[model samples]
Target: MLTFEIMLEVDENKSLEGNVELVPQLTLDCVIFGFHGSSLKVLLLKWKGTEYYSLPGGTVKQEESLDDAAIRVLKERTGLDKIFLRQFYTFGKVERYDRESIRKKLAHLVNPDLWYKRPISVGYYALVDFEEVFPNPDLLSESCGWWDLSDVPELLFDHNEILEKALHALRLELSFQPVGLNLLPEKFTMPDMMRMYEAILGKKIDPRNFQKKILKSGIVIKLDEVKKGVAHKSPFLYKFDANKYEEVLKEGGLFFI
Candidate 1:
């Protein structure tokens, strides 16, 4: 288990500082969401010399856009490039900087005056192929890996809120986008698809009904191949038809399965 230590800075007024004084320094935090087996998880990095877990993030370079910075950060931390990443929301609360955990973790590197000032952060959310990504911790992080979304420990600053929002967005995307394809392999079985959907929706779907609905959707192309080495009869493997999937997305088709 990981434990985060909270440190508070005491000012002359002995009150937490406001964001008006700390808006100049900005950081970009990315919540990398992935699905493995029947579980949903997020990638988090452990900061060096700190016990806290944080989203894989970095500061924007002076010459770069926030998007580019996020990509760079993701590649550096997760060994993933050209992934499906998106900017979800910006978090700029005055109390964001006043958190005891943040103040303590950063106190040694910054002056007390600067530590108390609030810095606005732009939060980006990314959906990556988990098995394809090899997460690498950067210079600032001691380690990096996936943590089950439902089992995440205490996160630093306002990261908890950002992660929650990312999960909410993902659930909503399940209804609109062919998101399950991103999490699955190039070729997968019907049960594999059903498991991924059930993990995201957090419900027990009727297996037979699910198979019927998905087959009717006509977005899945059945291959002439069958999964090998099973005790029972082999199940046919299927892959998403990218063109048809896009058309369904454009038409806002419902994927009840």
Candidate 2:
């Protein structure tokens, strides 16, 4: 079974001549979110002729499982491997692709007969470090890059809806899971954690109250070190204690969240 970390970068326009043809009725969309130092961004690709941007997507190959296909699509775009993806939602509305603009785009890309088939998309999301990823869109796109979640460009084919749902799913995950663990560095400050959570949660958490609660959770350990070269007293650094985190994972799975 794929443990969700096997990433292999392939040419976005890799031909399907020798391999099995894709199952066109079903598609997978990857909503890759990256954390820049202080803000959250979503990866997007701009198609060759269209001004609209979209999630990295592709058809599921006949020989592969959904997870396998999503991973393949993930690799083709971001070139990252082994990152965990959360299958958040599925969009199967009959009118999903009926938009005139989408129809025009599809006409240029696929057969007229195939476009009539209701294309159901499985939405999956993964978190990656912004500095580590390089946008490598497929042949269909002229460019790809990161867009701040707050200022995402106009999208196509119900893509705006897909992105909204994906962001909602991410917010839900952050409520009970330490989703930030993968997005943030190994070492960081309490304020750093708060900013990420607030960005995802869309609200400011009480600083003093959150600090007391998080420190008491015992999952993060305070270190003796502090950031240097600052005029003010530097805040002490803290890191998630993996040993304690593992113990909790083994003992009924609890986190500071």
Candidate 3:
């Protein structure tokens, strides 16, 4: 039995290859959300030599803080050093520690004993600009890419439940958080923002009403520019006023969809 004190004394800054030490009985899973082509997407890693997929996740190093570990995992998978990330929940259900299932999927990649140790996982969600992410798989996975939220398949371990919880948390935040600042590009049309909201909220919004409410909040500013190179009439481009958005958030102003 590996004791907690023994696990904490292991070396830090080394790769996760062969008996690398990590904080005992604790891990994290990240649900990375992005928006593209009018669809909400989640980043997933395809296991090497298997058809199964899962969210990008990792264990906390002995010397690493939880936030630092999550940031490192996000950077590894998305190639983004910074983004909007938050801890929403902790999953420690006894049944979540499905050792046999983990063995079937990841035994060849990581220590077989790993699954038997840590059953608790900290759940985190991140919002990133879709176009900026260049997905990279970990050592155990062969491919990394996006899957539409509606199309995501059953994931390894309890990740599907984790993903569902993340989405639920995101929807709750949609009413007050400036989610678009991280998920959308610097410049986007009003419709693009609405689509992102609708996708996450799982419903449609009145375009005119959405425009009026969002503009009134002063979080977004209309530019003199319109989207270029489309056969149809181009929509005016809008950019988030980061300063004002933060100000409103500080003031507890509502962000209605």
Cα lDDT tens digits for candidate 3, 17-120: 65666877778899999999789999999977678999999888777899999999999999999889999899998888666776776665554453455458
- Per-residue lDDT for 224 in model 2? 86
| TM-score of candidate 2 to 2 decimals | 0.83
- What are the TM-scores, per candidate, against the unseen true structure? 0.83, 0.83, 0.89
lDDT of 2: 0.75
Which 10-residue window in model 1 sums to the lowest lDDT? 14-23
Indicate the residue-level lDDT of 158 in model 2: 83
Q: lDDT for each of the candidates? A: 0.76, 0.75, 0.84
> By lDDT, is 1 or 3 better?
3
Q: Which numbered prediction scores highest in lDDT against the true structure?
A: 3
What clash pairs does model 1 have? none
